[model samples]
Target: MSESFELADADRLTVGTVGPPGHRVFYLQAGEAGRTITLKVEKQQVAVLSQAIAELLADLRAPEAIAAAGELLEPVDPLWAVGGMQIAYDQDDDRLILVAQELLAEEDADEDDAAVGRLRFTREQAAALVARGEELVEAGRPPCPWCGYPLDPAGHSCPRTNGHRPPTP
Candidate 1:
């Protein structure tokens, strides 16, 4: 009952974001024949996807795929927001396949308005996406020294402080 879309040979495929480093929204975008499809995604999803792609590529018989610098990631209006995400390797085609399900409210779980999409990308394209993901993740708030939690602009309340003033060092 849900809608579906597939981009088998996307001319452009990459993970992108909107807004500043700490307040950004992640998205997965694919383009072909002047048309583009965008799906909302979580930052953690991007990180996982990037690592998954890298690992999958490493296991392939093909040579390692390294992302070239300065690749451009264009923006697109999300056709549908995404919730669950999945990835697979298509050995026959030598492609990385990604699938995303539309974001749904708890009450709407049984509704038929859900959207599902599949995108296939070459090793090169997948590697490029991973590179961008790494950059975006690192651009966020820096981690605290005492604890590994990310430091907010106002600073994190380090548990190691035991309610005392956080160590300056």
Candidate 2:
């Protein structure tokens, strides 16, 4: 039972996390001159969302249409954690749209209990968000270039290495 909101013309859009890699929490947030909204997001969701937004921007067919994306990644007073998210591009307005819905009790399937938030940003903003996402994700644990798996602080077992650790010099 929460109120829904929208940032139709937000000045900033960012995705980032807090804490150490294995103990981090991801978030997505947008804001305007005087309004801001933040929601907890999953790392997988961030990856998917970033790829989707990037592909959508590429479909615009006009590189110049993209504006400079602000690279800031901080949220102010997160409203709530998001349960589900949806995205689409408004062809008529040339805007990318993202919707985040507040998580409700699983047993409560009633539509009336849903609270949805929305964000509409320009293609430039979408591009910027995508870039930010890439930076944020890469900042985490460095992956094993061999098998493409995360390399643990104690070293990882690269399956490609035939169950052997990297040769110790």
* Clash count per candidate: 0, 1
Candidate 1 structure quality by residue, lDDT tens digits, 4-80: 79888877887777887667888888877777787878888888888887788778775465554233355456787
- List per-prediction Cα lDDT, in the order shown: 0.77, 0.77
Number of clashing residue pairs, candidate 1: 0
Error of 2 at 50 (Å): 0.4
* Candidate 1 minimal-lDDT segment of 10 residues: 67-76
**Per-candidate RMSD vs. true structure?**
2.9, 3.7
TM-score of each: 0.82, 0.77
Question: Which residue runs does candidate 1 get wrong by more than 4 Å?
Answer: 1-3, 63-75, 111-113, 159-163, 167-169
In the predicted model 1, the residue pairs found to clash are: none
lDDT by residue (tens digit), candidate 2, 1-169: 8779988877778877777886778888888787767787878788888888877777776555545444435444567778888899888987778998887777976766888999988777788788888777878777778877777777667778887668231
Off by over 4 Å in 2: 65-76, 107-111, 143-151, 154-169
| Candidate 2 RMSD to the real structure | 3.7
